[model samples]
Target: MDETKIAQLRNQSIPPARHFIDGAQVSASDGGTMPVTSPIDGAELTTLARGTHKDADRAIAAARGAFDDGRWSGLAPAARKKILLAWASLIEAHALELAVLGVRDNGTEIGMAFKAEPLSAAGTIRFYAEACDKIFGEIAPTSPGALGLVHKQPVGVVGAIVPWNFPLMIGAWKLAPALAAGCTMVMKPAETASLSLLRLAELGHEAGLPAGVFNVITGEGPVVGAALAQSHDVDALVFTGSGATGRKLMEAAARSNLKRVYLELGGKSPNIVFADAPDLNEAAKVSAAGIFRNSGQVCIAGSRLLVERSIYDSFLEKFAAQAKAMRVGDPLDPATHAGAINSESQLARNLAFVDAARAAGRRVVTGGTRILEQTGGTYMAPTIVADVTQDDPIVQNEVFGPVATVQPFDTEAEAIALANGTTLGLAAGVWTRDLSRAHRMVARLRAGVVHVNTYGGADITVPMGGMKQSGNGHDKSLHAFEKYLDLKTAWIKL
Candidate 1:
């Protein structure tokens, strides 16, 4: 990366004007703003509009107006489809900028963010754009001349609260389907990383979305996020965060107007590597990637590695070696395998988890300490823990860090039992070449999504959600439309 190339990349990444409301960029009512800091080096990246309750009110009112006015809701399916496709095109045009912002704001590796986030976001937008036209009403057989039909209608104003991890992409996952259903929205981006979402709102306006159809409010969760969840004007609430926060949002929604709530919450997913795995070496590499990718901040990260007792020694040897070899450095560096933790608090929490695992008699196989000399940023070395029991605190809790605890299981039944022991049922992986074992594991697993031989592989075409405390309601594919639309049975008398 020469000076010219670096300059070109930096020029390509432009932070958007902070607040987007009613198709305009404006500051908070109180003229208050917060500095958006890059997690890479703790540098102040940009100042974003710090939304207050007044701003939240304005955004909600705008969303309500958009839904009631029917500028978007009343548009023909084809017209709406065209506009959404245009929005997707704008996302594609600024994909690199979004990815760069993601890395700068959230400390995600630029290369991974570039390849994964933008493509996923654009694919989501395109998926919903195509789905807009496909949403149809169906006629049912009726007696004589009587008419009976089922029609799916937009649910009106929607409040979308997205997490910092994969900010723009997950925001798109929430925004696209809701917009395609002709619902107006108020988006609440996470306080830590909101740059790309603000940028998305700008592109959405340029793509010809109606005023008030899309609005954004940026503030802390207790203030802005709670208001969105509890707003009477918001007909539905969609959230991605911790299970505790999701529960609070649910309560808020109930207290306000019993608004529909969809939540995608926490996970303590298990990645099982069996003795009969074809390639223990490859399994170790894939498992390392599964947990350490994104600094293991992912909600569906396979944080718990359950190995068969017969292969635990060999597996730990290879896994520890791979973990030790990961390059933790600046997210801007394309060669960097892992980046810094998102924030100081997150780093502290990860460190505490490591301590707890050690206290519980688990052996630290590899990296565990904070790399302060690496940069001023929050960086946790990739860690591997062995001899962890199923009852260990680290194994059961959602550490949300670049840490993996390897626990040996005696039999397939024990592995299944231990994997499903946690309250979360978000995602799990089974690494084995045996087709019968794969089928059996998939059938027996309690998670909503189970990976057979690999992990962390999902697409816009697939429906994603958790079975239990991880939260409900599908996120991707046509099934996600159910959360934004209501089905009505209409009967007409001849």
Candidate 2:
């Protein structure tokens, strides 16, 4: 049982969650604590500080002092690389521990977390670690007797706020490059998922990451997160969350130090299927996997499925059957394709969208209700809605659940038009055997990342971001390093 897994974690000597500031694990100012509950069975794993603006202040101060002292920032790239690589290695070794904690806390399926979270995080850390010593500067030939040199330096005091769905992995996405670039960071892990982050802080300390080089404070978004975003000492703020929240963060950044802000926000991405797809059965299967993956909690989920009108009925048939066959149960179950929603609030929000769509007269082909009520784990079955129009709210808005809306399109141009209809340009996917049509779709889609004949798959080597309301800048890959570093030019006259 999923509850059994929760008990297993409890039986182990799991450390208590606490604030890590200046390399010390401490409690809230008043010793106040917030219960860290497992969505797996609504069990309280441990309690962490209900971090406040004051907590944010403490972390920021430490970060600023670290950056100014240059203990981390001033180190040779190779030295920094060594510390970061060791940190990555330790994380890899503890990958399973991290994954189990994530599944227990974040409601990510244990099956997926085991493969995705800690390993990906470790990979991300190493990728950037390898790049630390390789970052180079350039010399420009100046006019007459002058020399101009351009250099890249770490932007000091980055404030990173990671999302609840993939807190540890996304934190690594921000942490790796920022640390490699010699920047100190005060990380704000999502309140729903802070245990892994706290553990990460502990692991980093064990790996000899200098005190204050990495810090963590956990609290509600309005308090600790806002304070961090509004801090004048923070040079840059990077976030992965809702577009609505991203807009507010941008404003806060402007209001504070006019610091740089990078965001990877929400999406209502589309997955289009044409009649002549390379393998229609495989296309349907993969697309179902896309939206249904992570219970559709991912920002780049193919929430809107647009099938060619000619093959609409048959494709929907295949997709609906495939989705229904997916087992929905305990996060700890390896066979469970979908797990719990992160929290009660998130579960309610997901259910509301499904209900609203059903009320709008869209056909619920399968799975529009909560399941696994016995486990007390927050869960919803894989939901597929058909006959939804582009203008419908269900089609236009991001449901953020194991839910998808289906529509039919006749032509490639129509498919592109429908896919780009949303304000988000985060991600989209197309399935087709026509090479020209595939190229056309990729070139025309407004999303920052597109998958041809596939969906929702990107590695550490590729850049991930969005356009329009999806926010600015990129995360993952070498491009992410750009946000953490500042360019400086020096001129000399001989």
Candidate 3:
């Protein structure tokens, strides 16, 4: 990490961004543009083509045509694998540029953004690239000298809606596997974080992805996202965003061609700490990082802290100290532990949660106020609210900020109940050295991923999905390929 180079990149001018549709940079049909403001400071970095339903239709038509003609879909699996690997390599080659661009766009700390965005995207692409060629169709068991074949075919065209917090990373989570499986795609990057992914689309084209094989449409979610969801030509839709938007996509699918929908909606995940645990200090540190990292913009962030009553006071002390110690400032600065909030609106929302907690007489354990406003960027102190019940709105809802709520539970059953009390069950953390209790908690927790001693850092080898309102269908791992593939059975008479 060269600080000088990062600083230079941070100051460099960005080119005008446009939608990458049909292998070319294009403007919206209506010639509209949206100003892209960098949350690193209150500065307009660039302008992007403001897409609409017509633009989406054009992109989808291109994808439909490409899929139908087999320009990409007709290629051999190894050929597709080669191109995808090339794309991944291109991403790695431009990792720093993309990371800086993303941080400037979304205000994630550069230290975290480098790995979380571009490098993570590259790794994801490579993971699916390696797996695509190895999957085999099955030969079904049959009677009387008859052979039955089961084929795995690519679902035609895929539509993806990715969020702002980790645009490139989450975009690749949908893009890589679908491309690996030979599905053409049209994507709508979140309005706030479109630059990196638009650049990613260009790299994909440079790596020899055919026109319409992978397209990006940039604009507001309601117009562009809704178009992608409702397009009858789109065979499946995958999204990583809020639950409200997820429901709209589902409704659009139902009204149109009934495209398969896979959603990774945000969660209010809980992190539990017990008395007889491993190092409480380390648990407290990891738990704080789990939520506070990326400014708690992660979909599966540990926003709820459930501490055992026996060690409640002590654990709260450690946690609040950790929160207060985090340096929240310019994202480009390497010394900063946490970066700016993604936008002014999000900062306001986070503070509202804190103010409500205070109004209700909850103890503001550490931080609850906006900070570094003199710098003209959106930043907030990492907040912890103690003495709150599960019924508190701050505890129940996904604040999607650096705000965390702490509650105490006396018994193991009570801890499990409180952890599972939220409707959103995306991820959870259980810190305990007791092997039997760890196993029991893992079994009992309703989340998609449960960490026994760790809070975050689950790798791509495992599936990440949600249960209940958190939405369905897994991302990462081999299971992700299933969403892009369709199984067909062949019956023959002998």
Candidate 4:
């Protein structure tokens, strides 16, 4: 991570991206391509193949052929584990290169992307690799003359669509488990962030993954994503994106072969602070970091903050100070605390939320404007809007940027109501020294993951998902295996 080396990698030339289908890099069938512009400096980074339904069909056929022929699915569990471990090691070896490439592609700060993108992906692959051999079938008790057995098997070809934010990390969450469970895969990374994943699949092949066992197709979601969702050859579909897209994928599944679709969608998570919190300063720091890190592109970010009326003013001061003190600059710069927003359109969307709140007579407490326009990169100052009501659009919608809404509540009951007011519940946080209240909040908050006295930093050991409009299905744990696997029952008579 030397400053000079970082610059060198940043300036390194990245080749045009191509689809990795059937174990070989190929162009779109129609020779179509799309320009990929860097959000860091507004430079054209590279071009990606503009894949169409034909490309999707080609990849699907490859995966289907590989699975039906048992090239990957028929492998011994230990053998699959060995190859996957090799893939993880290769990923670790190129961790820095991959991290820098991802930053250049998606504008995530190197400090965060280095760990969150490549290193985290390496660990996830390693985790699932080690678990493949350990997974077991079951036996069921029956009458004396009868014997019953239960078996767990790979669900066959998997189709995954991951978003631009943290592509490598989220891609592995789907790829590793499916591959380890003996399923072949065809993945489509977001149009804006397909380079890292294309490179990742190449590494997988280099680590001895069989041809067609893992394929990646890059293109517009409407074409590639729809093709995958509706492909009857695909046994299941996994996605991590917005709620509207999730609903569309579900509908496509129903209209097709009823392919099981697993979605990890958006969130408007709440972070509540009680007067008797352990340390108000620490809570403020963590809460600010939770929402603002990665330019608040995190799906589980604590976007809505609720504080007790008694300590509301003091806590808001600390939180706003934290947001203001963060350095927003080039993602490649190690000194930067926050990076560029992913794209110009996304930055405009974030600012619109702030503008609407300002016009609605809400207090723009701190940092709610665009900055660094001279650099030609899309950047937004971390924004905090205080005195926000439950009905505020900023409070209800998922901005997916470094924007947060603050509100004060008089009692724990009111705090709970405000926290749970949104239809989306992916994650929540409670800061309090009262153990009883902590447990009660955990029980009542309708979120998949609730952080007590902490925010964010939930490792891959637990499940991460959402309830309500936030979408369904879990990611990041052994629980994730449930989606890629199928259970079968066998009855025997003596």
* Candidates, ranked, lDDT: 4, 3, 2, 1
lDDT, residue 215, model 2: 99
User: What's the lDDT for residue 196 in model 1?
Assistant: 81
Work out the TM-score per prediction.
0.97, 0.97, 0.99, 0.99
RMSD of 4: 0.7
Measured on C-alpha atoms, candidate 3 has an lDDT of: 0.92
Tell me the tens digit of each residue's lDDT in model 3 across 225-298. Answer: 99998898999999999999999999999999999999988899999999987899998899999989888888
- Given candidate 4, what's the lDDT at residue 113? 94
True-structure Cα RMSD, model 1:
1.7
lDDT of 4 at 176: 94
RMSD of 2: 1.9
For all candidates in order, the CA lDDT equals: 0.87, 0.88, 0.92, 0.94
lDDT measured at residue 382 in model 2 versus the true structure, 0 to 100: 93
- CA lDDT, candidate 2, residue 344: 86
Greater-TM-score candidate between 2 and 3: 3
Q: Which portions of model 4 miss their true places by more than 4 Å?
A: none
Error of 2 at 419 (Å): 0.4
